[model samples]
Target: MQSILKQKIIGIDFSDYSIELLCIEKGFWKPKIYAYSRCILPPGVLFDGAIQYPAALSGILKKMMLSAVPNFMKNGLCVFSLPDSQVFFHEFIMPAALGGKSLRQAILHEVRTKFPMKFDDLYYDFIVSGKNHDTQNILFFAAPDYILEKYIQTLLDAGLTPIAIDVESMSIGRSLLNSRDRRKDVLIADIGSRYTNIIVYNNYEVSGIHIIKEGGEKSTNRISEQLCIPKAEAEVIKKQIGLSFHGQESEVSEIVADDMKEIIREIKKIIQYYLHRKKITIDTIVLTGGCVLSPGVQKFFQSHFWQEVEVRNPFDKLRVQKNDEKNKRNVLFSNVIGLALRGLHTYPHLRGVNLLQKARSHS
Candidate 1:
């Protein structure tokens, strides 16, 4: 493995609606943010976590690099994240007697049997959490081979070195939770433009991840339909009066409230599964991503769930350079920031889930 202690890494996240990039320098005590940028992706370029137009997307990435920071393509090591909806996650136990090649074979065999899809069609990885009496608990992650290849080829075409690829759930948990927070079981809800990712962390480890096909775009569309206004105008209205239930645009609030209730309903299903399976009760819920910027969204979640709810700020521990007002408060970059932190080895506990690690080793 390469030493990330003193390296500068560009972390990129590709969502259905936008692409986010962040450059950071890893310092001994703290990480320093160099520059960050977000570009709205053209429709049909990406859909349901699949790249429909690789060439067009790569062209946009090349332009984004040149515009964000001059000479950033030179020796720029990059890490990117996969959308949660496209990835598969499962937790299982394997006999501890298996070790070395035996353990590897056992895991592969189990995955082949338990995974719904064929093993040849996927790139899968696992993290062994720990050993219990006679078994080892493992968390598995897998993504489609074509999807991973498209992203890798896109980065290579843009003249960037791809170091690692991760999923949004792990990145969200790593960036939002502090050391103390990790010690306790918590739930993280990341509401992006097109999907909402719910992650359950037990004893500071990822236990479950679920993705719903609803997000900020759904709420905006609801507003647009209800008021017969343009999407742009509806988006503005949604942000200004989101689920507060008080204002002249209370109708907009009602629309957002309905969408939020659906999101919370899915979240509760995941919570219920965890509680029934592991007997773990999550006491805190951390909200992050672009949709969380809506007004009163946090309060709505707090009221709906008994757990303490709070919005995530990725710059809480890092020293942010002097920047404009917009960059300082941009919560949408949480996933990218987490990718950079992981690339920099900032959080030891959240390491080694990179999908590209095995490929790099074989190469």
Candidate 2:
């Protein structure tokens, strides 16, 4: 495929744990990493992935963006991915005859039957994937209207323009897999601060996501409780002494081992259920997020799953000129990087659906 000429855009993402920002100058081939930064938010600013204190969080975000990209106001182009909990997706078949105005009516019909909440409360969009005989398979994604409104308000207050609000799981798939990867079914384990999103990438669109309530912070807390250390110090020490205890009697090692296994178990259960009902078997396993940084985590995952497990660095594909060793090594920034890639719309990956198109036009 040919390359996109050029554009400038930034991708911003935030969780209960922190705020992340990334910018790219899309060019002939690989896009240059224009600027990037990640800043930890104050405790209690976010709870369960929702902003508990919008004004203060907005201030923190503004300061971080200013320091990283001083000229952000000039272009102000960006995409934001909200916390995964607020974003929901489902796949359903639509008859080919309902391809026009009736398609919207069909979607609304599915919404009324599937979603407990009223249709008026949702902000939704759909992307058609493939046609089977007279039917079409489309992925539907929606987030609460109030959730989008509050977050978009915060972005505006932070002095940025958001062109699209994205689905987190799709962002993860786009960042790791490209056109070549479209031939295989890839399973991605995106372990975040408080949740691990298990995403299944079928040929084109994201097949499904199963959010496990286990993540980096949770493991740190367990280590602190078992080792009698402060949570801050526990985080540092957990990274220092990972799953490879190598036949030691250390309780810290035992605690860490159990936590890792539990996460793996949950993921396996989800995969088994999918296998029973589908023809696709997982082709590869990709691990992302800070939680997977524990020394032997990737090795342990491979041992249990008996597959090729890799810690993916999204920057490896981009044309980054600067010597930002930290950015190249960190996997936590995959979501934002994918967001920026979608903003460019150059890559061979499917043009993932955006939830913010309506909101952007209204603004």
- Predicted model with the maximum TM-score: 1
lDDT of candidate 1 over 1-363, digit per residue (tens): 335445567888887788878786656778876666679988889998889999999898888876775234344668888887888888778887766667767777787787567767777777777677898777778888899999988888887777678888888777788887766889998887788888888878777778888888888987888889999998888887777778587888888888889999998888888788888888889988777887889998998998899886778657764464555455777788888787666542236677765422210
Badly placed stretches (over 4 Å) of model 1 are 1-7, 69-75, 321-329, 346-350, 358-363
Q: Which ranges in model 2 have alpha carbons more than 4 Å from their true place?
A: 1-7, 69-75, 247-250, 321-323, 346-351, 358-363
TM-score of each: 0.90, 0.89
Clashing pairs in 2: none
Q: Give residue 302's error in model 1 in angstroms.
A: 0.9
Superposed on all Cα atoms, the candidates' RMSDs to the truth, in angstroms, are 3.1, 4.0
How far does residue 319 in candidate 2 sit from its true spot (Å)?
Answer: 1.2
